[model samples]
Target: MSGLTNNTPRPIDIRLHQASRLLEIKFDNNMECQLSCEFLRVYSPSAEVKGHGPGQEVLQVGKEDVNITAIEPVGNYAVKLTFSDGHNTGLYSWDYLYDLGRDYEALWLEYLGRLSAAGIKRKES
Candidate 1:
């Protein structure tokens, strides 16, 4: 996980990698984040993406090749990313982004488990 704190998410610099479906974000404190298309899709902050709460976050599959089409700011506190597959509802807040970057591994593992339980595979078979 990156050294993302409140200070780290203060100013976010985002870059798009079309070929690999990766979005790289650099924070104020120089914390670089290389989030994959699938990761962003699955971890989207939208109500539609996050679901109602824990245990409801739907497993997003077949998004490994998805690309970030656009990045729009949501006021002054967050960002909205549009994917090539057409999902752009999520508003990723500074706090949420920092938390995700800080606890990337644990949350990612938890997501993997949930996917397994739901019998949804990440990569194409």
Candidate 2:
């Protein structure tokens, strides 16, 4: 069990820009992704962020100022995000990250709509 598994990544690159709150992920297959901090926060894979299931996610609010504090690699296929807001349980897999990037716009709007419905405003930092 000491040896690496067959699925061990040959290569993957994740670049984070603190000023921009953006992550640029380059896959081994040549696919590239650009993701925003807000996008990543709402789509966090942690139960506190995502809830137990669909339709149960607790809407993340007041997070307009949140930023990634660190990107810790998990094995070969995922990374753990340490957020400035103190959330670090979300284990973001490559597949999940890809889906988040692909569905960014719709998801973000939905989240904003939720905020509006709850009378929550993102405070300026």
Candidate 3:
């Protein structure tokens, strides 16, 4: 995953809606997205999920009901999310978050494909 770039739009506001299990973020560039907690958890930038290099991605499973327990800011560039499943290693930078929102459909579909191919059925949320 890429880090912050010169044109990366910073988040103007970040709100966690616990009841809805969504993270609503609005960027300075007028872009906004509501990302599900499950989506964020599975796409976490942590080494445990992303691995150290290419083709080493560890497919996350059974995270449909996972929710964010905490959101701690790391400097001005990123936020560290603590999930209910105890995952708190990923530093979700602004650019990464933006990309995730921008590419959500494709990423989510890919994840679903992987799960299907592995014969892993996601629990209903």
Candidate number achieving the greatest TM-score relative to the actual structure:
3
Evaluate candidate 2 by giving its C-alpha RMSD to the native, one decimal: 5.0
TM-score of 1: 0.80
Question: Per-residue lDDT of 27-120 in model 2, one digit per residue for the tens?
Answer: 6667677888877987788999778877888888778878999999998667999999999999887677766666777878887788889999
lDDT of 1 at 87: 94
Model 1: how far is 86 from its true place, Å?
1.0
Candidate 1 stretches with Cα past 4 Å from truth are 1-8
CA shift at 79, candidate 3, in angstroms?
Answer: 0.2
- TM-score of model 3 vs. true structure: 0.96
- Sorting all predicted structures by TM-score, with the top scorer first, yields 3, 2, 1
User: What lDDT is reached at residue 51 by model 2?
Assistant: 80
lDDT for 60 (candidate 3): 95
Whole-model lDDT values for every prediction = 0.76, 0.79, 0.94
Candidates 1 and 3 compared: the better one by TM-score is 3
